[model samples]
Target: MKLTVLGCSGGIGGARSRTTSFLVDDDILLDCGTGVGDLELDALRAVDHVFVTHAHLDHIASIPLLIDSVGESRRFPLTVYGSPETLRILRSHIFNWLIWPDFTAIPNRHRPFLRLQPVKVGECVRLGERAITALPAHHTVPALGYCLDSGAGKLVYTGDTTYCKPLIAALNQTRNLRHLIVETAFPDEQHGLALASRHLSPSLLGAMLDELEVSPQVYISHLKPGVGERIMAQIACYAGRLRPRALVHGEILEF
Candidate 1:
């Protein structure tokens, strides 16, 4: 399977910088961020499932707009998968009519425009030959990383996280892990702020990498737009033997 990077910045500033979002093949979305807005109408309609990492606006900015744009044209409801806490937050704040219309109940409940599925850590959801599993994450909000196994090879996306041992353990156990897309949100100078915000800095990321057993093609993503250069330079010094390159806006990874 091929995974396309739609947007991978932690925050947006210019035309090329967009918040986190990734498209797996053509049918699945890892997170529907601002980058999703760049897709054509038919490309938007092609998405059948969205697996959300958390309830953060930067990660889910396009869900409401996406559903409104193509929900009526689709033959089936758009499925959005998330953790229980994340879903509760969306229902309470986002889809509660005041923020955005609850498409889960729109056009009659029996055949609504949207569907919600709650997935727990360690749970695997299969779609045809693809297996998408929710991995552990430690962030400010309820969050999850994912491991996508395409039968032959695997790719792991560690959606916004701090230093968490469960994540490292899970990664070490994974087989055929071809690509690992991870986040290093801040530079080493902002280590204190990064810890407070439950994000990873260069030092923290290196510490995690030290425990890894699998040597995948690591690609660093979700850096704060302005200070990406400094963070990456620090990563070069601290990130141990695996020299992970920065993940670009439109980069694609096939596994």
Candidate 2:
């Protein structure tokens, strides 16, 4: 499986600063953030499934637009997978016609442009030979991370979480874990804010890593736009033993 980082910044400022989104192979998306907008119309139409991590705007900002842009060209409805609570939030707030048209009911209910599927933690949804499993996440909103198993190896993405023991435990149990893409949203100076927001800072991330049994290649993501360097420097000072590197936009991981 080949996973490309569409965007990894916590917030947007310039062209390179795009919110979280990952393109999995060709037909799957990890999140539909602003980074998704960068895809061409044909590429947008090619997306058959999206596994959302949460309902935060940064993570789902382009979902509505994506459906609106490609619903007509697609032969089958686009499927979105998330936690029940996250799906509920999307139904209640996003696809409620007030904010955006409910594509699931558009044209006809039987064969609509979109579909929402709820997945629970530990549930693995298999598409072809690839298996994507929803993992536990502790964020401000109803959230989930994911484990992408290519059958050959596994790549884990800890989507916007703080210090979560269950997530660590789950990762520890994963066989052939090759890459770990975790979040460190703020610098240690903003540790209090990070805690309140249920996001990890450098110190917290270091602490979390100390409990890990598996040593996958660590890639840090979701760094706030301006303070990315400072946060990464702090990560170097605190979590340098793990040798975590910043996840960059357009970077691809093949396993």
Compared with the true structure, all predictions reach lDDT values of: 0.94, 0.94
Off by over 4 Å in 2: 239-241
The worst-scoring run of ten residues by lDDT in candidate 1 lies at: 235-244
Instruction: Report the lDDT tens digits of candidate 2 across residue range 169-232.
Output: 9988998999999999989988999999999999999999898888899999999988999999
Cα lDDT tens digits, model 1, 1-255, are: 999999999998999898999999999999989999999999999999999999999999999999999999999999999999999999899999999999999897999999999999999999999999999999999999999999999999999999999999999999999999999999988999999998999999999998998989999989998899999998888637677889999998999
The local distance difference test score of model 1 is 0.94
lDDT of 2 at 220: 98
TM-score, candidate number 1:
0.99
Prediction 2 global C-alpha lDDT? 0.94
Error of 1 at 37 (Å): 0.4
